[model samples]
Target: MSTTSDPAALSQETEQRPGAKTRVGGLNQHQMQEEDDIETVDYKMVTFSLAGKDYGIDILKIKEIAKFSSFTYVPNAPPFVSGVYNLRGDIISIIDLRVMFNLPAERKPEGSAEDGLILRLDELMIGVVVDSIDKVVGIVSSRIQPPHPIFGDVNIQYISGVVEKDGRLYIILDVDRIFAKGKSTTEEAESLSAVVAPETSAASDNIDELKQQTIPGLDGQSSGKNEEELDLEFIREGLGTFRGFYPDGIADSWLHRRYSEWRAERKKQGLDVQLTGEDDADNFMRTFFSPYSNRFLGEDYVEAVKAVLPEEVSKNISVWNPGCGKGYETYSLATVLRMRYPGHILKIWAGDNDLLSISTAPNLVFGADAVPTLYEPYLVEAKNGYSFSSEIKDAILFEYHDVTHTSTVPDIDIIVARDLMSFLHPKQQASVFNEFSQKTSTGALLIVGQNEHVPESQDWQHVGTSVVNAYRRL
Candidate 1:
């Protein structure tokens, strides 16, 4: 999917010429000339139908397409939400695009459907329902044009492009934008207002007391220090408050993005502020660290990891697996390498800030079903559940290391930090990015989160499809 723009871009493109007559005809002379000017590229698209209209999404973005299943409804959720469901013990929210776009409601609320496209975006998994999947067709880039004005009924900004094939138009929908906007439907505003109305007074009183207790220099009334210094202190106190509220998975990037606007409002009013309200914190936390990514051992993602591997497997290689939650990814990588290149020496140094999580890495035990089917050969039945082979255990050296600070990690070849950088602020992200480049060998592979793109200006060159964020060190 491409980067998204606001509604103005849609309006500007849809502006009709003075004598322009909207018709379903072939391309014009100007469009044909433009097509000839550029090299024609083909993108493999998984075409699906909704409300009897055809739409397509990039096949690479898809993790696994499954049949429709029953979901548990969430009360007070947005109108477009179908509800949540437990997919193999992982709870995922389902979104009904039919209702989301005000199309004719054709899908049944409960029952199996033809297909559900499962998308893993930023550690969150969402299943989108469609009537039936057409064929995986190749659409040429030159044939793709800007969104047509007829799509104004649905939100136009979400349409990335339109392609004409076999005298029919296929609208390319940007999944990222659809999920971002659909999560906050119009009904959500009313729901949020009602929930906040009763708590406003009590929250005000608590904020007043908290400011007096937490904000430094507020009681002293000192004037010698600069305002910028005081503002910095205020931010520090705010972050501390947030830490107290959330003990695990707290990222400064998420904190600022979630509350920066509110902080600006407080500063404009010339009033000292405490931390953000409980509601905002709850919402942001839920969005960032969703429960759906429990195993982090999906087959499709593991295959993508395998595809980027260098042709010549080194006899001895070092790898750094940062943010190795529950060591799921750590074990998966070990299994892949062991099977792919037998007798190859592997030295993986996996670490996570979460102490309890990193501590369990040495045990090499996993739930009976936690391990993927392909890696089952490496598992031995244990009293608890299953334990990986000793060979698998010997390949890793798990440690407790925080990437935020200047800490020495083992000289490595590959670094797998998926969905880890998204939690960090831009400053921290850059710090980590530079550190990864310095720590890795020349031409080492960097497999980041699906949507995490390494800038071209940096010392990394993007390899393979732009849809996949795999990079090779320069």
Candidate 2:
């Protein structure tokens, strides 16, 4: 698809000249005045195409129309959220209009000048990827009508008004109504956008700085906490659910203050103020269980994991991958080790406490989205999605084991524990660390979660790749 002129360019073209006739969105000066006279209210809308259908969003909602560029993928985001992109200096979340509207995904051929529109929804900037840019139109209030009952699959509420311009219907979207109910938050939309920036020579040293960033999850964590107000009732209800999994002291302090502010801000925006028990439960599970194995290394932390791997290892390497969610980390390490020691006999003991996940781990299948270049060699075309090669799969011993109480995992050369530390109580974490210290021999590599701050009291030496939190048993 060819991208038509953007709103800015279109406006420049339509500006009246001393001797030139002006045209606004294909209308001559006469038609523009006629449109202005028909209704006291007129709207400037930027129209775009999604799956062959033309739709319009209020021009005021758009920050700018951005060219198609590479974006960073966010795992476990809502289906419509394509990813995030850095625009100029600000990061903006890009939402695919095709996916959001339940239309077919549009893929433009290579080297296209433009492929999406960046919108400023409320306080956040979001990119809405479209098939092509259509012209900017001035719609008269008198000509705008309610959506027909037979409108296409898009949710009717998203359509503010419909108009037949030159026998083609243009669905005018209500910006506030469509996004007001979105799971997207002002903070999360901003944070994801903020992750990627143009690195400069002056800032190269600062690039490796370890910063604690929040992962997008329950209670608007993707979006930062809103602090303008506090809702005590909302706080009380959330704390009730939180107390079941975590200590009351935790709920009383940082967690309490965090949720209270978020709930109040969400309430003020007329967003859902109450989280279902399942919402809280899922966050707890991801925090403790490390269910997102594919995502663990997608951040800047992956370099840290790669940096700590041994250049040359024994012909026989025994590895323990705890919190091995769906076997991604287990298989990932096996793939790397196999490449490093192509002739070695690799024995990986991977386990998780979740029975359902452990059962699924052996299959070694993952969604097509997980097939990044690093993971592609081991992943083969599988029935539903993708699976690992037999060579990569057969080396792992998948089991159900709770690491918190496990005492014996002997002769381990390396232990990869990602996202496991942050979930445990401080006492439990200390206990697990102590157990790890006793079970592994000297010089054993122990890798912890990226954001986790392991106790300094433990007698362990920090290995390189500080972002990934790797250590050597001293």
Among these predictions, the greatest lDDT belongs to: 1
Q: Rate the local accuracy (lDDT) of all candidates.
A: 0.66, 0.65
Q: Report the C-alpha lDDT of model 1 over 1-474, residue by residue, as the tens digit.
A: 221213356455547522242352344555546757763444767788887788988765666677767678899998778888677888888887775765555545556553677777767799877777787767676677898646743556679899878777789988776776455655555564565453444445654675566456554655643354355455545443553332112243444454555556666977554446555444434434422254745676567667777787445677888888678778888888787678877888888888988888778566877666887888888778898787888898787877777755655678877667765544465557767865764567887655455643346777744323578876
Q: How much does candidate 2 score in TM-score?
A: 0.42
Q: Report lDDT (Cα) of residue 389, candidate 2.
A: 88
Q: Encode model 2's per-residue lDDT on 113-135: one tens digit a residue.
A: 44778777668777888888888
Candidate closest to the true structure, highest TM-score: 2
Name the 10 consecutive residues with the lowest summed lDDT in model 1: 243-252
How far off is residue 1 in model 2, in Å? 92
C-alpha-based local distance difference test score of model 1: 0.66
What TM-score, computed on C-alpha atoms, does each candidate reach? 0.41, 0.42
